[model samples]
Target chain A: MKEKPVLRVTSKLLIPPIMLFALYVQFHGDFGPGGGFQAGVIFASAFILYALIFGVDVARRIVPAWVSRAGLSIGVLLYAGTGVAALFGGGNFLDYSVLAHDALHGQHLGINVIEFGVGTTVAAAMVTIFFTFASQSPHDPEDLRDEDDDADFDDDFDDDLDDLIASRTMSQGLSQAGGAGGREAR
Target chain B: MELAVVIGMLFFMAAIALAIIWVRNLFAVTMLMGIYSLTAAALYVALDAVDVAFTEAAVGAGISTVLMLATLSLTKAEEKPFRSIQHPVSLAVVLVTGGVLIYGTLDMPAYGDPDAPIHQHVAPRYVQDSGQEVGPPNIVTSILASYRGYDTMGEVTVIFTAAAGVLMLIGRGRSGPGRRRKTWDYEDLEGDER
Candidate 1:
């Protein structure tokens, strides 16, 4: 998948717009068919695409596992802290009315910030899931055994042949089927 | 026209389900699941639940398929052939549950019924007053964020907890080329006895 020039060029070109769309979905959620959950997933998907095209290590350097880990909590704290802030301002728990001078302004501020929190957590969760699942340490024999245990070995070797053909057909667009080096099959 | 599209989508969904069940190849199954999600999202759009459609498209179609593929890469792509016959007890349970669900649907109000139990609730107030009460023109956002801010906050917390759980279980935090993996390393080199 990484070898093809067309794929690399197009994916590099495509990454920004996808990210921009995700942002649009994040902020324009109130007015259109978009929201934090959707935006977050879209954002993660764009990163995943970048990882797919560029490399996991490259993408990791950009996003950083630590940053996402911080995001996981920071997003939640932001949302919860907003509520506590409102409560301290002489309103009930999560009551946005007292957060600002007026109710309308408070609602606007509250929704945007809370939605941002949701977006952050969701995006971080998604990327974390991808990183954990996709990047397996290849040299580990014990981890290999874990996979072997889960996978029931087919007695017939021809099944592998069939699987090969099936995979070839399935991975038509993804032309780098054979001789794929260092990277796992996505 | 809406009814026709709904019917078509449902048929496609049923066919996709059957194909998914029939396909022993996990990779093919994952692709079918993506198609299923896309179909479901389209159906949501037809129903005018654009927010739901968006979520379905992003979460179900986009993220879920990628996750499944990732899992498949980690594990095996071929499912073991079924050696056992269908269990009568399980079949009986499924039948009973399906029958009960269908029977329950009989007592349910028609779709888009204005006087439905849900519509009778404070949804009306949210719909009517959201524009004035909350500055947001989108009532759903107003209700989700402003009106039920605590619930939204809780939802964010749940997502955060999920991320934390994943991190605790399998997060490879700050792993470089030489860095050893974390708890989710899947590398039980010690072969610690269970």
Candidate 2:
């Protein structure tokens, strides 16, 4: 049996740090160069790497198709939901100041929520694409069968014609002998 | 020291951009483009446009690459051979654009000079009063979500629209279920005695 390539120890070790960096970017958007979108990609890339190494089937098993779909929808909804919340708070749509009586706190909460939504949607979409491509089976077996049948038909037809010709020649010889006997008696 | 670093970064960014344009393989070009976007984001950070950088890094490096790969998967990765001499025209246009941009930049403020008109503008008010008025530690967040809340809403809507477009373009739609039926039929046939 052929051995399958396993996920390397280095990749496994790298995942934790990448995940931590994603969190750092998510929470530390104010002070640092990173934020929700970059962080989200980095987060997704970790999983993508895993999928590349272990195969798409294993990755799909970890993050199922339906779940990724839900994640995509949920992320958009979560981002949109923040805006709706602002609308209900008696301000124009997405006015985070209205989210709390203290407008600054509202802004913080709103950005956080929307960032999370963006992250989720981006990650899920990436995984979903990988799944769809990787899951497709390569060969169509029916085409092979059709070709086999054509070959078999040609072989069978040739053999059957040969058998029929042999039988006909034998019967004709027997009939000729009988006729010869009858003529001799006369 | 910072100016030297910025110039070095710009050179790196230009190299990446050139590499992306020159790469023959679409997938390789996409990857290089992601690197180019990241480098651009880093430049944005040096310029203190953190929010824009963040968005660029995410959309450009992450979503754009995925979308490109998805598109590549649906089409042939290689460009079809063309007998046209369009390369010279493309190079001329690119060079002209680059010249104009460089000429425009020469008149702009030196990189990150504190007394630059940008630093003296209403941005100071936002940076200072955002904590007091909007109550967010991240002033950009405060401004984006509060003072310019309607714009953010519009942006989100745009994202939704793009996602919808992507779903329409790449989605399996009604054909997925039909494909499953074919697969199942094939399986059933395979199970029968040959």
- Top of the candidates by DockQ: 1
Docking class of 2: incorrect
Model 1 error, position A105 (Å): 0.7
Count of backbone collisions within predicted model 1: 1
For candidate 1, lDDT tens digit of each residue in A54-142? 54555677988888888888888888888898889998877787878998888777778888888888898888877665554334334
What does candidate 1's lDDT look like per residue over B121-182, in tens digits? 89889988889888777677877888877677778778777777766665544554324543
- TM-score of each prediction: 0.83, 0.66
lDDT of 1 at A39: 84
CA shift at B112, candidate 1, in angstroms?
Answer: 2.6
Instruction: Rate residue A2 of model 2 by lDDT.
Output: 10
TM-score (C-alpha) between model 2 and the true structure: 0.66
Chain B TM-score by candidate, in order shown: 0.85, 0.74
Candidate 1 residue-wise lDDT at B80: 73
Candidate 2 wrongly placed segments (more than 4 Å): A1-9, A30-33, A129-186, B25-31, B48-81, B84-117, B174-194
